[model samples]
Every structure is written in C-alpha cells, then in structure tokens.
Target chain A: MSLILKAFPLGFLINHDLSEEENVSRDLRFERENLCLIKIATNLRLEDVNYLMENLGIPYKYKNDNYFLNNGLCVHWESYQGHYSVFISANEKTLFEKTKRYVDLIKQGELLFKNFDIMLKRNTRDVNSKEIFYYCYKTNFRTRLDVLEALKKHQMENILSNTENEIRFKYNNKNYKFKRNNKKEMFYIELEQKISLVNIGSGKKSLIVKNLKTNYTNMDALLKTLTERGAFSVHSDKYNIYCEMSGMQFLFSRNNTRGQYFLSVDRVSDEELCTNILKELDEEYGLNIQDIVYKKIMERIKDKNMRIESEEVQDDNSIVLTIDLG
Target chain B: MGKLKIKLLPDGTIEMETKGIKGKKCLDYAKVLEQLADAKTEKISKTDEYYQNSYLELDESQHLSDN
Candidate 1:
C-alpha cells in the first residue's frame, strides 16, 4: 500500500452521493487507486454540511477515520489496504493560494525582522488642528544583536554614533515628538493635542480627530488623525531619540529640531513600498488586496488600539497613518 | 413574503436590499446577511417598495376595518 494525498473540491460533493452503487459509478472517475488515502478540502461550515445532508438531496458519509475542520479547510483520511489517503478540498485553489500568498507576504516582512534588516517606510502630512496624528514604518534587523540595538535605541538606552535617522522622544507630559535628520533633509516633529472623538457617519461611529496640526500643509490630514489616535511611545536610535506612533515613525537628533519647519520623513519611499506590496499581491493572488495588509502592518508596530487611513494624492503620491490616541 | 437581495459588493463588502420588506423586517433581512458576513452596513437606502408595502399594509387594514 502507498500513501497519496489528494484535495477534492467540496462544491462537487454538494448534491452528489458517493456511497450508492449508482452514485459510486458516477463518482468512480474521482476515485484513485494506490489503496491509500482520500482527503477533502472544503470551505463549508459544519452547519452547511448538516444542511446539505438534510436538504441538498445528497447522501454522503465521512470517508476517512480522521475528521477535522480548520481555517476554512476540512481534512479527512480514508484507509485502504492498510494505508491511508488524505483528502482536502477548497475552491479553485483560491483558498490555498490566498492563504499561501498571505502567509508569504507576511513572512516577507517578518523575515526582515528575523534577519535583522531595518525595513523602514515613513510618511508625513499636516492638519488644521493638532488633535491627532498617525504614522507607520518598518525596518528589518540583520541579527539578534541588531534587533537588540535597534530596540535598545528605540528604548533610548544607548545612542548610535552614526546615521542621524529620525527618532522619537517623549516630553514630561504625555506629549510625543518624532524627529529625523539627514544631510539634505530637514527635521520636524508631529505634536498631538488631544486624544480622539467618535462621530456618526453613515450610521456607524467613525473614529476621527477633529482638529490636528502638522508641520506641512501638503501632508495628508487623515494620516495624522490615525497616528494621533494610535498607541505610541519614544524610543532611542544610535544618535537620536525617536517617537514610534502607530505606523508613522521618525527619529530626531537634538540638533535636527533647531528650525521650525516640520520636515516629513521619507514619504516617497514609504508610498513606494506600499504600492509595491499591493502590486505584488494583486499580481500574485489575482485578488485586489485591501488596506488590510497595511492595517496589519500598522497594527504590528505596537500592540494598541488604533485606526489607519490611506489617501492618494498623485500617481506616485500617497500617505498612510496609524493612531491610537484614544 | 418579499424577497431580500443580498449582494457581496465588488469591494468584498456586503450590501443588502430588501424588496417588499418594511419596518423591522427590513432590518431582519439586513441582519441575516450582516451576520453571515460579519459585516456592518455602511449605507442603507429605503426603497419605494419598502415605503409602499408599509403603507399598503396599513391602508388595507384601515379599509377592512371600515367594512
């Protein structure tokens, strides 16, 4: 006896009986030899299975001794000639491909973290009032020590000697500021004035920050609102203190803040990565990915309550935010 | 019984339209799809059918009572 695993589509079994002699004759085409196993992958809920058994005019029984349901996939195994064949079924490989694609996409970022590469993306914007702010960025470390150094720097333990990336710092009050400085780029800070407010829109309470102030007028206001509402804190970089707020993050050296112009961290790079990720998903999965990936990316930055918004300005211009000020 | 049309929008959102349903029953039909998709209704439009059925039922009862 040999073992072979097969995935069967559940839709095919909806109204078909596999046990009856007549039914068996019809479904024998689906049966395979090697006397081992049968597996079915199904997206049906238990209630659906029961409903089908009762109302779908189909007679079917569990073929394998093993029965379990998980993550929209049902698995079962049948024994033949002292061997087993496993069967799993789902729709059009979409479920499998989608799950695999999702896992792969997440892993791509996670691998950066695991490998110790600082994968960073940043955006900046302005608002009428300083009530709320939101931001998101990613950086991967190359090694455990790199992660430790980055986190330690984030925690403001030891300052890095080189590279004046934007950093975050917390003042005496709960007030937070994100600062960054490059040779050519000026430094700026985002200040949040209040927590957040919930307003009814189209019958649902949409979390929003009414008044917000930012250093730049061209910056997206919705991004600022999300950052201000999200959970954030100050961390240290090698030479700068950084504010990590939701998804919008920046490092600031003390010297970078002398002027009043609130410089936005690299928005182009941030938007590019976002566009790349979405493009990749759309190309690979053939499914139009929503903001969920970006939302999850923002959520992973910190464990806190937050909201995010993304807006497109130009063909190459966009902004995103993560806030948990409430 | 009025038929309820529930559609999963292209954006992966659920939109529910209740035809010949009125009052709380419209909500009931909407809730069924809502529960199925774990979704919140973003916008709801009260159709002419809804208002017509609601008023027609009231008018029929009023006419019968007059007899």
Candidate 2:
C-alpha cells in the first residue's frame, strides 16, 4: 500500500484490571504486525482463547519459519476471527523485556521514519482492551493524493475507476488499488504485489524478511489473511511494467531523472502480432526515442536548448552522463 | 536463430537472456545488456550454450561474422 508511516505519537500499554496473581503472571504487550508478538494465556477472561489457539493459531513465522529475531522487546495484539488477546506468560520475562526494549526504541524509531513514508500504529496491548488510537503517515508526500497525481501526470491512461475518488489499474502486470475511505476519511492505496524497480529484495542478506504483508486499507482482511496464512514473504525478481497502444502491451518505463523512456516487445509467441504492434509503435510514435528522451531531459532541466553529454555502454546494461555546468 | 529476452524484476533487477546463440558469443550480447542495465553480475551459469560450437567470430565492435 502507498500508506507509508511518516510519524508516530508515543504511547504506553497499561493493564489496570489485573489481579495481584494476574498482574504477576501477565505481562504488558506491544501491538504491531512485524514489530509486535504476544502469547495468549488461557487463564485470562478471553472466552475463545482455546478456540482461536486451535483454529487461527500464531503466525507460522513463529512456529515454522526461521524469520523471528531477538531484535527489540515488543509484544503485540493477537486477534483471531474477531477475538483478541494481548497477554503472554510472565515466564517469557526475557522476550517480554527484549520486546519492550524495541518498543521503547520505537520512541527513537519515530526520528528514523519522520521524513520517510511509513505506516504506524499505537500499541494498547493491555487487559483493558478497547479502541486504540492507530495512526498512519505518508512519507513521500503531504498526502496520498499527491502520489496519485504524480502517477497520473506520468502514466494516467492505464486505469479504470468508479469516480475519481477510487481507481484501480494494472501497471507492469501488478494490480494497484487506490481509493478514498469515507468512513475513516483517508485515502488508501496498495500494490497487489510489492515490486521494486530497483531489484532490491531486502537489500542484503538479513534474516529480517520484511513482513509488509498487511492490507492497511482493510484491517479486517489483513487479520483474516494473517490468521489463514500466517506471516510470510516470497521474493520475486522477475516482473514487468507495460503500456498499451493499438491493442498491444509493450514493456514500458519512464525514467524522469535520467530523462529516458523505453518500450519493447518480446517472446509473445506470435510473431505476426509482434510485427503488427511494432509497425503501429513505429508509425504512430516514431523510432527516434533518443530524441524524445533528450528533449524531455532538456525540458526537465528548464533549458530547452541545453547541450547534453551522454554515454551509452555495452557489455553492461548502463548509461552514464554528466551535465557540464561550466 | 537467436533471440533476446529482457525482464524487469519486482526487486528492481534487470535481467537479459540469450536464446539459441552458441558459445562465448552469448557473452557479447550479455555484455551489451549488462552495460545497458548497469547492474553488477550477482550470479552466472555457464550453460551448454557456452560449450557449443564457436560458429562465428566477433569483430572489435561485437558484430558477429560467420567463421
């Protein structure tokens, strides 16, 4: 989803209805998806603890996958089919403490994500469970609309929407759903599958597989999916972004900073179809894309007659250039 | 006949493969793509394509001429 967390107000998780024994045996919890984890003890007032533990179960990342890390101390809310639990064994004192350390660091984490787009929420993983204050911040723009506008300005034609309030489209073979939520009074958008054009899956060999698997627009759906599949991530590097002209999908990309655009057709299994599409693109759009990219680059630099210095390299998929300021 | 397949990955990787080309000549095409995409080689598998007959010689400019 385009819902990037920009800021988070620090809050505390408290337990007021604790019996002296319940207080000693129960631990305070943190709430989150990737950041929060809590165990459900049967002695608590939760009625369906047994049922949920049996049916929904904890995330497989905990039970099956080698994904958990002893990063920070944060115990979060665990919900199952409308039932919620936020307590764990006081015996997990070490985990609870470590998770707490992370929770406390979240106060510091606020500074780390202040300028960047991120999604955030407040943890109220306590016994007095009620409506908690959850917040999300968009890091890339003042608001989500700005993202939509920029996308439209660059590539708007490939879309179908019921009113401008909500739009759904496929770009690069991935579905994008963007819409305004009237009830929450927020605009939300999500990529059907996470695609990074920069080919950055985790960036490095880190065990922390980012569990960005939540549907921020629909928390109910998010919870249900989590309960069904558990937390998991599968990395795919082979993907495509395409544009249509004359009933053919041409792989397309627009690099504004580089001032370049690319379109190509390949492996379509039908050579005739490919030839036909190629003819249309050549006749309608022309074959001189280098000129188009050069012009666009000049326009971006605000000097229509700017002299450009460009380099194209072979034996490596790269082009490097420098603008002579002198 | 040889063909070039270019792929743009979700993880921000650009990959190109040469099909039906013989011998070290595929590397010539691959080098051109590598230059275009500007990505460092993370892994390379020398398939049978690298072992087949060197049917053509590459010029200094990489244009292939039949041996």
Candidate 3:
C-alpha cells in the first residue's frame, strides 16, 4: 500500500500517440548507432586485414573467435555471402570514399595471374622438329612415349651406345643414330645414307639412293604392324609430306645437306587449350596472389610501434586479430 | 589510444573495425588499411561514432628566470 507502481513512464502516459512515434524513431536511431555495415571484396583473410591495419598504423587488442559482429560495423566480406542492408551518415560517407579507393588500389596489385612460362614450366621442353622426329616416332594416334618404349623393348639388344643423351643402334644392316641435345629433352638423328641397286623392268638394274626416308617408311610399317596392325596415313602440304600423331606433326622434307629427305616432327601447340588450362588454375588457386599483398603489408607495418593484442584461428579457419595503437 | 579489430574469413574476405578513433582520421585509417590488405571496399556504412569528433593533444613548456 505504501509503494505505488507506474505501468509506463510519466511522459509516455501523458502523450501516448506522440510518444509512440518518438519511441519508434528512437529505436531506429539506436539500431543505426550500434551497427555499421560494410561489404569487402571476397577472399580477404584475417591476417590480410591485420596486415592492412598495421600498415595504417592502427593498433588493436586481440580476441580469437567466430562470434558474430555486435558493435561498430559488420562486414559482408566473404564472396559467398549475400548482400546486407547498411546505413551510413552523410559525414561518415566521405571517410569511406578514401577507403574504397585504397581497397581498389590494393586489389589491383594483389590479384595477379601467372603467365605461360610459369604455368607450363615443368611440362615445357626445348622442342626441335628434327630431334623429336628421330626419337619420339609415333604411328597413328599413339603417344610418343608409347612408341619410344616399344622401340626400346624390341631393340634393346641392337643398341650400340645407349645413354641418357644418345641411343645409337644397328638394325637390318643399317645404322640408326639418335642423339639428345645436352640439357634438352629433344633428340636428333645424325644424317646417314645407304645406296643400292634396285631391279627395274625387263632384266635391267637402276641405281637408287636411300636415307632416313627409307628407314622412316620401314619403321612406320614395322611399328604399325606391331601396334595397330594398320597402314600408316600420310598427309601432304605442298613442300612437305606429314603425319599427325598425338599433338605432334611429323614432316618429311628434302634435306639439301645430304641430298635426301629427313623427318621433322613439330609440336602443334593448341593456344585455346593452354588458355583454358591457365584459366582453370586461376579459378582454382588464384587467391594465392593475395599472399604477396599480405607480405608487403606486413613489411610496411614492421617496427611501426603498433601493438598486436591477440591473434587466433577460428573454427571456420578464419583468423582474428586485435591491435592497440598507443 | 586507437584500436583495430580484424577478421579474415577462410574464403579470403577481410572484416575490420576501428575503435577509439573518430572523424576524418578514421577515413584515412580505413583507406590505408584497405590498401595494405589488398581488398576492395564494396560497401561501407559509418557507425554513429564515425560522426563524432576525435581528440587532439599538444605538448608545450614554459620557462621562467629567477634573479
């Protein structure tokens, strides 16, 4: 009986309708004051943010967790995340413009891609047409590696000087010399020739010259017999007779030095295919370039008198850092 | 003293906040941090604190001679 309880505040009870509108306005303002929203480019990691803060000479205290952002601002930083509603004051908008510009500049430097040389370094070979034709002989669509293995398995006994860079052998009373360039995967056969008499019509003999061409035909027939058991297909384009096999084009052209024809296998590079492969790499592991940016940022921050409060890995593999700028 | 809090998600996105700093100085700080982080600022909304003024201090000394 001595204590009186009021169900509502005195002002709210006095001005019910006006107070209702005011209360709504005040609630909205409170929400706006508590939260600031930001969306950053996706793929930025915790360490990256820390590095950036350090470069900016901002210090923070550390706490590691995946807790939701409750104060100041919440960032929609992950690319996979959807959009969020944000409210910004007019004066504070200017501050963001500068930040936006810096973000663009940093992204320009960090998001770099690897070129052909770096992408295909391991698969690259110093290709020479003459060299490839000699050692990497192929029939139909079989691979160069397959043909080479077959030759090795069948002709191991006939090999005269078989080393890392050279494989010289005598087969069918004819010498075959295959040499690989030093520090190169390409192999070349030194020019060798054999001349003989061939029977012509009406009891007569004609003088004929044979070189790599004859051996090429013989080897072609032999490998075809062993593998596909089919005839070799030939293609010609004006000055050269060629055979396309497993990303390689073997061409037989006249060699003026020996007055004979020699085989030359050139690699047919598919630009579109290479481009697709590089694109795939960029899509799969492209974010690695950000590491360079992080490193550069850390470099700028080093010895800058900023203090790191805490650093940790969250359940989602994200990193959190707090720094204090004293 | 000024403070910064940073979060890096596994997907390579960065979340950052500045505390105990206000006004245009915060903007400058944001710009520098974004540049160092190599991230683009897609969206930015200022909190109430961003509209508040920051503090400044000056150090000075006075000397007097006695006869």
Candidate 4:
C-alpha cells in the first residue's frame, strides 16, 4: 500500500488560506493507502526546522517519536551511525487537495509558476513510470528578476526564496536573509552566520595607553594647544585623530561626553612624553583660570571705582594686585 | 588696601589668597573668584586677620563714641 501510494506525484505543501476549499470533500484519499501523499518531501536542516517552528510560528505535535504538523503531516528524522537525515512527510488530505487545486490554478492562468527544466520522474525502471510535470510556484516569493541577476553578478551563491518576503543567500562565507515588505517597499537583511572569535594575545601593556584625560572640555582648544606645542595630526577620522609629537605617535579620541577628548599613546613607551604633555596641559589650564579670574577681578574693581595701587609679580610667578578703596 | 595674590600652579590648581580684607569679606571675593574661574574650591583657610575689623570700621566706631 505504501509503495503504491508513493507513486503519486505530489509537490511540497505550502501553507495558505483554504477559504475556497470549504466545499471540497474531506474524506477523499488515495485508493490504495487511504492516505494523502506528498512525493517531493523537503529535505530540511536543523536551522530550517527552527525557522519553521519558531519564525513561522507553526505548531507541531510529537507522536511516536516523530513531529506531526497541524493535520498529521509528520516531520521525522533518521540516524545511521552518527549521520542524521531530516525531512517532512505529508499525509494530510487538506494539504493534498490544496496542492491539486494550486496545480490546476497554475494551468488555468489563475496562478503563475515557472516550469522547471528537471521533470520529476518517479522510478524509471517500473512499467508504470510516468513523467510528472512539477512547477516552481512564483506566488510563494516575489522579487525583481533583475535584482536576482545583480545578486548573481556579485557572486552571491545558493540564493533561495524561502517565503513571500524572504530571500536567503550566501556571500563571503556568511549566510544572510534579505526580507522585504511588498506593501511598504522597505527591506532589511538579517545575518544568519556564526560569529568566530580571534584570540588577541596580551603582555604588551606599555604599548597601548588609553583614556588619558587632558581635562579640556573643548576639543578645538585641546587640538589648538597640541598643535601649538609642535604636534601635527597624521591621520584623522570622525572620532579619533592620530598625531605625532617629537618622533612619537599618539591618538586623540573624542570618546568622552560633552565634547571632551582623550589622549591615547600608541606604540610608544616613553613616560617622559606623557609627563610632558600632562605638564603642558596643566600649565595651559592654570593660565586660562588665571586669566579669567584676573579679568573678573579687574572688572569688579572698575565697577566699584577702586584704584589699583600696585601690581607686582613675585619670584614664584604669583601675581599681586593691590586695590585701594576710595 | 586689599591685595589678591594668585598663583597658577603647574598641576592645573589655582591658589588665591586675599590680604587686607577683614571680617569675612575675603570669603565673598573667594566665592566670586571661584565662580569666575568655574572651579571648585578644594580648601579654604581663614587667617586671624580675617576676623579682625578694618581700620575704617574701627575708626568709625571710635568717632561715634566721641560724639
């Protein structure tokens, strides 16, 4: 009965609304096996099974060590000495009816599909072997043929349409799925590749110095100071600029908040350069504070109509401003 | 006469000392300087002179007593 039932040519089951099939006979089945059959069973991998179970939200029932779909369509796996084969077996009557209707619709111009070159020939050695015409349905997926041609031109391999809005392809040893919404015309690609880690060995602590704050909130002022001190920018990007000072290379990165910049010494282990930069920056900030306070004091004195009796500079570079109250 | 001695340090610290301003008046100037510099005051030490009254205030009190 199984051998006779296997002779029937049935395509893979595609899930769709069966509102037009409300009047079809439900008890119809193959004469010999009394079970609806699917000949082109889809050979699936673990990820494909996951995509069916998780992404498509298809419910399955486990029975007799095999997973059965909504209507007794079994998805079973077989193992032989550590090698595993997984495939879907269709046994539902409704699904077989839909497949038959779909084939008829394609033939009658109500539906559309491209005729594949390879004819599905079941058992050529048997006297009852017949050539069955199988069609690759275009309704399941929609994409411009030019877009597929362009993808092929760019060396994208194994491009397959899995659903209405999804196209899975492989490029640069990475698998990705491109999905598009026909209504909104918006699309995005999801990466379906495994991440591999590269080991970066350590023990070169003095080579890379990171996150050294210059305490200047303004990046322009900081760069100006560095430029004035004979450091020239060698390379620059959006966030970081590499500079060289006195034959040593360093990086200035805007990795901090509020327009602040950080200095990272790259590949140079000279502690003196770091100390010198800190000293110069310190002096610059101190001078800036001194100027601001001096201006503020002078403005206050002018507003109060006070007289400056004496202005002196001490040996330690301290400024003394004597104000006389009138 | 009031003297403001400001030392700009190499470590980005500002040291300010107010002389001849007595009776907490120097604290006002300290606050003003800190605000103008946009810096936080790490330490403040008040000398004995900060507690002393100004010569003008002392003279005014003496003159009021004579009157």
Error at A283, model 3, angstroms: 6.3
Q: Where in model 1 is the C-alpha error above 4 Å?
A: A1-326, B19-24, B60-67
For model 2, the local distance difference test gives 0.35
Q: Pick the candidate with the highest TM-score.
A: 4
Q: lDDT for every model?
A: 0.32, 0.35, 0.37, 0.46
The model with the greater lDDT, 1 or 2, is 2
- The alpha-carbon interface RMSD of model 2 comes to 14.6
- Docking category of candidate 3: acceptable
* Sliding window of 10 residues with minimal summed lDDT for model 4 chain A: A109-118
lDDT score for residue A306 of model 4: 64
Q: DockQ of candidates 1 onward, in order?
A: 0.01, 0.03, 0.27, 0.25
* Fnat (0 to 1) per candidate: 0.00, 0.00, 0.60, 0.37
Error in Å for residue A25 of model 2: 29
Could you tell me which 10 consecutive residues in candidate 4 chain B have the lowest summed lDDT? Answer: B4-13
Error of 1 at A237 (Å): 23
Q: How well is each residue in A36-116 modelled by candidate 2, as lDDT tens digits?
A: 222321112244333333343333334421222233322233554465543321222345564643333333233222211
Clashing pairs in 4: none
Best by lDDT: 4
State each candidate's chain A TM-score. 0.17, 0.21, 0.19, 0.28
Which 10 successive residues of model 3 chain A have the least lDDT summed?
Answer: A1-10
Over the full model, what C-alpha lDDT does candidate 3 score relative to the true structure?
Answer: 0.37
